[model samples]
Target: MFSSALSVLALASLCAGVLAQTYTIFFDNKCGRGTPTLVDQNGAVLSTGGAYNFNGSIIGASAFLQTGSCGPSGENCCTLKINDDGAGPECTKSVGTNNCPAEKCSASGGNLVIIFCD
Candidate 1:
């Protein structure tokens, strides 16, 4: 019985690891008028524009664009939310001039491009 319980625990651990998925998020800022800041689910700054590897459990990820110098002092900003969906990767802007619609992921993990305009 003791050995059987240990085997079950080991199998469960392996299954849990297999079920945990990781995604590579690419944030592209095409906004000509501002500097973008990427924020994760916990409001931690991820990156400006590049790549970030995130666990599948992240939620409420967003990106903000500062129209001035691209920092805390910048004014007139816009917020874009990153949606977690199995259908594809999606991004939606709450405010600002969006040049393109939300991008979709090509696979389970893909890039999300945010384009802003004046």
Candidate 2:
């Protein structure tokens, strides 16, 4: 009975790890300037690093390089938003980020790359 219980506990822990969800953020600051910023739904700062790792699903997140023109949450600028909920980048060639049209990315696939001036 004790052996059976131990085995069950071990299996449960392994399953928990396997079922965990995670994502990664990579900052490709090809512009060679400014700090990278990431913020949550409520405009809370998450990271200002080369990369960030997230656990579980992200919601209403935004990321951009702080070139002194954008907000802490990458707000107050163009609609170049990014989301964990499978949205894509804002703006088309005709619309332009300078006058963004609204869009974003995904978190389920587990990778988010934020580029600057490239």
Cα-based TM-score, every candidate: 0.62, 0.67
User: Tens digit of lDDT per residue, candidate 1, span 13-93?
Assistant: 999888766666664555454456677767678876667666554467776665554434222344666766643456665
Regions more than 4 Å wrong, model 1: 30-36, 65-75, 85-89, 96-118
Q: Mark the regions of model 2 whose C-alpha exceeds 4 Å error after superposition.
A: 1-3, 85-109
User: All candidates' lDDT scores?
Assistant: 0.58, 0.60
TM-score of 1: 0.62
Check candidate 2 and list the clashing pairs. 87-104, 87-105, 88-103, 88-104, 89-104
